[model samples]
Target: MTTPLLTLDTVACTRGGVVLLENVSLNLLPGEARIVQGPNGSGKTTLLRTIAGLQPPSAGKLQAEDGAIAYAAHADGLKGTLTVAENLAFWASLFGTEDIETAMSAYSLLDLRNRHAGALSAGQKRRVGLARLLVTACPVWVLDEPTVSLDAASVELFADAIRQHLGRGGAALIATHIDLGLKAQVLDVAAFRPAHRSDGAFDEAFL
Candidate 1:
């Protein structure tokens, strides 16, 4: 039996008291991925954040099957003072792992192992973030614009990594504008666009 990793039923997200997305429903299963695509203000980030537990959904229910999710945002979450190896090692430890070498080579970062994270460029730092995903074994990956600073080759490397993850029975939920080199179910946030109301009679403070 195939168990869904996550499920969102009539999910609605809001920012600044304004609805961004509403009535979104999706099922994500193991070895599967769903790519979120939409305009800049289409609430793509909000949807991913809401599922990642970083933000609260304005309405509807979100359920997770099992295991904690590994979230990698646009930020690298690196400590400038630490070395490339050190930063990844720290994250691995938190996830109950210590093998950093495997992640280092995922993005061709083995050579930069000893380099200070502060000295790496934006792209290098982005690779470091991608490596963090592999440093530990997580069932679900929630990525937002993960390939932003990566080059073509790096993007391919990331794609290959994602394939490997799916092959190992993992699932991913990604919000990206670029091609990730893998076919996935596409969700257009615009479909759930909120209806504009001008009456302004309801007060949200009550909720």
Candidate 2:
């Protein structure tokens, strides 16, 4: 049997001391993609954040290899003054990788390689940000609304990159509303939301 790259056993996700999701469990294996689906405030982002180690889970068991996950959130995580190539180079070096050629080519960033990230449009910046995933050399990807500022073409580019990553035995957990045209498994957060708030404290966090 193939070992799972990530596993969450009855995990609970919380934000600002409020439990948004409880008893959520899932597993990601090699060459698999799982899409998280939920309405606004369904704890999708919180779930991803917990899984990416950005925040601790409120409860339950979570397991994954250390330094095995590459996360891309709503923020582009770019240096305004650095050129696209320089940004990628910085990440590549940080992750012990030296190749940025394929990553740039995959996102059609060869043309914007010389431009500073701050000068690029929202979509352009998003493309460059997503491309960073390629250089991290991690086997697990955890993304939150990766297509936020991407256009149709750029979305296709990102989807193709993911497909290629899966082809190479990588796994992904994505949270997005639009379809990326991949045969990905889906998880709805509604199932994990508590049926009733026992404390009666108003839940205001954006889940």
Candidate 3:
């Protein structure tokens, strides 16, 4: 069997006396993608955040073979005053690379290169955010609702980028409500939801 880029074994998401999910386990292998789907209150975003190292798992083991994660969540992670190309260039530079053209081309952002991030529409901003993943060159991606605010064509573009990323032996853990043509394996966070919370912190927000 191929080595897994990321591993989560019997992970539980608990906090402040609440149990959101339990007994969650998965192996993210190279070139593989996993779709995390659930209802509004389900812990989809929680799971992705846990895998991304943004949040610590309340229980169980988490490991990564590649030890890198490129994560994008609800926030677009863009500077409003900066242009599309500027944002990408900044991230690329931070990642120790200087080639921003490839990422812009992948997301069809060439036309918006001069456009300020805040001035662009939601879909345009989403494209820019998605493009940052490619610029990072990280082998694993953890995305939460990456398709939010994207139009049909833009979604298709994002899907193609994701396909190409996986084609390069990258792995992804995505939590999304809309389909992005990824052909990913399914992981429904609702399946691991606890019947009740012990600490009276029953509320959990969705991404």
The TM-score leader among the candidates is: 2
Q: Model 2, 152-190: lDDT tens per residue?
A: 999999999999999999999999999999999899999
What do the candidate models score in CA lDDT, each in turn?
A: 0.88, 0.93, 0.86
Candidate 3, 15-36: lDDT as tens digits: 4446779999898999999998
Model 3, residue pairs in steric clash: none
Pitting candidate 1 against candidate 3, the one with the higher lDDT is 1
Q: What lDDT is reached at residue 65 by model 1?
A: 49
- Model 1, residue 151: what's the lDDT? 90
State the lDDT at 156 in candidate 3: 88
Residue 113 lDDT (model 3)? 99
Give the winner by lDDT: 2
RMSD in Å for all candidates? 2.0, 2.5, 3.2
